[model samples]
Target: MKEVRFFYAPEATITEELPQDEATHAIRVLRLQSGDEIFFMDGKGAFHRAEITLVTNKKCMYRIVETMQQEPTWRGHIHLAIAPTKMMDRVEWMVEKATEIGFDEISFLNCRFSERTKIRTDRIEKIVVSAVKQSHKAWKPIVNEMLDFKNFICQPREGRKFICHCYEEVSKEDFFSLISSVSQEESLHESDDITVLVGPEGDFSIDEVRMALDNGYESVTLGKSRLRTETAGLQAVSMSNLARRI
Candidate 1:
């Protein structure tokens, strides 16, 4: 299995020395020696194979020897617009797990029900990076800055739009049910991207849901259970992936 590779975010192409933490971890923690083969495929969808050429107590350098591109040319993209939980740790966990399950975008919406008004981009980015490596996924999820719910509803986008809001008397379809239906409409064996919104702990406000509905967003449901924000997002992702597989 080519020893599943590792990649540096900045592509090891800078003139300056590697960051202290990165250097130390690559050398001291992973313990690579000169002449050992490895790869640092940049996150920009390119792969580079190399052999360790320089080694210090701090960092080990690799000489690029081979290059290739792997699978998943994005005809599909999972964009999850979500409300950040009051507990930032839960938000972190959501980013990490969602990346592992293959998400393309993490959008933060400051809705009426939102408990946390701010999101730390750096911390969330770290979680995405760790998840990409942990899950052996070549693609990382893009975590966007927080935006107001009303503003998000006005943003223009192409293709099918879905809003998963649990509301009474609104036409709601189970996420799995919708996934199955959407999959059946197209080539299931191939990828198809869709965006989903997971509301806050207090859930999406009635006004927020109304605005989304008025703007042509179809209402969808995860299931009978009222899930926490993160759980609902993952459930939707998992359902989409499974449906695509079918």
Candidate 2:
């Protein structure tokens, strides 16, 4: 049977009835019939394999056939602090792709050079859900509230940390190089736990870069090409995971 996945905001489980909107989507949109199989998640890494027992315009009830519980992820931890772009669409795209690529935590830094001042929460969250479903991933990324640029840069980062920046400084290493040099420990991939910072479209100021260094973040470059804020962030995420594949 084809599986339909839905995100329930309230609460959910193998026993709990799905919310109205989900029921509508399953019954009205997907034309899910009784006894059909589907999947639902609480977006907290709890995945339920459900079979439709009752389907109605107002509500739907499913019997939990299987329950796969996942711990809240810190696995392959990738946290990105990015500067919002002048065009909000870029940032929205960044969120969608980043979610698809998989990141544990995401934060926005309101950098001095940031062209875009405010973010549309509705738009970004919408992208996140679609990407989460598209990638068939059990976990979702937390899009944090915007941080003060200077304050953000000054914060200490636990575990392995790198700040992707442009301009000549110490010779920058390819993300793959950094990912490769770390030796794997136990079951976990080495360097799987990481945090990266990508600045805004306008880019981070000199002071911001300095603040990051003060906070223990190593200044690294992604390459010679000057990438947009969103591109840099997404690329870092992609590389973070792809390193495991290589």
Candidate 3:
């Protein structure tokens, strides 16, 4: 049996053809010919099994053989909001890994101590799409434009909210432990949303932390060792993923 290749094509259907970029890859890079089997994810929790029907240098047409709806492997919606690192590579790395690990949404925060306040979401979204295809994820993660620290923190959200900061004066709890407790309390559904805020290289300003706290975002710690902005973001996602296993 041949391993079925997965491609992202939200608009693909039983009659529709693969998109130009996907078609090009299928016909050129993969050297796929007519009758070769492949699958496409709509990035909305659905997958379509397809077979190539026509191949050209710039286009590859396909006929859908079947449609499959996949349930998410992880529970709840995991959202990570972080200040982009000074170096774009670090933030991009985090985005890729987090997508593979599974997350629902990502927000870029513009914080007081943030070294980089701007981000090109177009490039980042492409990275995210690539990650989803590479990871075989059925649902696409929502990537948002960068927002001011105070503005982002004040936005209304549901489920357990947390902010990771290094201020010792402010009481904090273990990230994983809080996740566990939040899940156990109130007999919450396994799919309850979790939103975590991670700061930049300089970390969130003390006043910013205070504002987040005032806005009902609990203070939490990844661990004793201080983490870089990108690392902290990934750690938050990792801890949340683990918390669901309990």
Each model's TM-score, in the order given?
Answer: 0.86, 0.84, 0.92
Instruction: Please give, for residues 1-246, the per-residue lDDT of candidate 2 as tens digits.
Output: 135555553366634687776677777888888898878666778777778898776778888888788664334677888878887878888888888777778888788888866777667777887787667667777777788877776676656778887756644667667765665564363345778888876667877787777787777887767787788888888877666443
- Encode model 3's per-residue lDDT on 73-191: one tens digit a residue: 87788999999998999999999999998888999999999899899999899899899988888999999999998888778887879999998899998988777775354645544
lDDT of 1 by residue, 1-246 (tens): 446757554554442233465567768877778877766545556566777788887766767777666687344677889998898988888778777767678889999978999999889988887787666666677879999998887988655567888778677877777656754446545447677778998889878888988987778888888788888878877766565542
RMSD (CA, Å), each prediction: 3.1, 3.3, 2.2
lDDT, each prediction: 0.74, 0.74, 0.87
Error of 1 at 111 (Å): 0.5
C-alpha lDDT of residue 121 in model 2: 67
**Which number leads on lDDT?**
3
Candidates sorted by lDDT, descending order?
3, 1, 2
Number of the candidate with higher TM-score, 1 or 3: 3
* Higher-ranked by lDDT: 1 or 3: 3
Backbone clashes, each candidate:
0, 0, 1
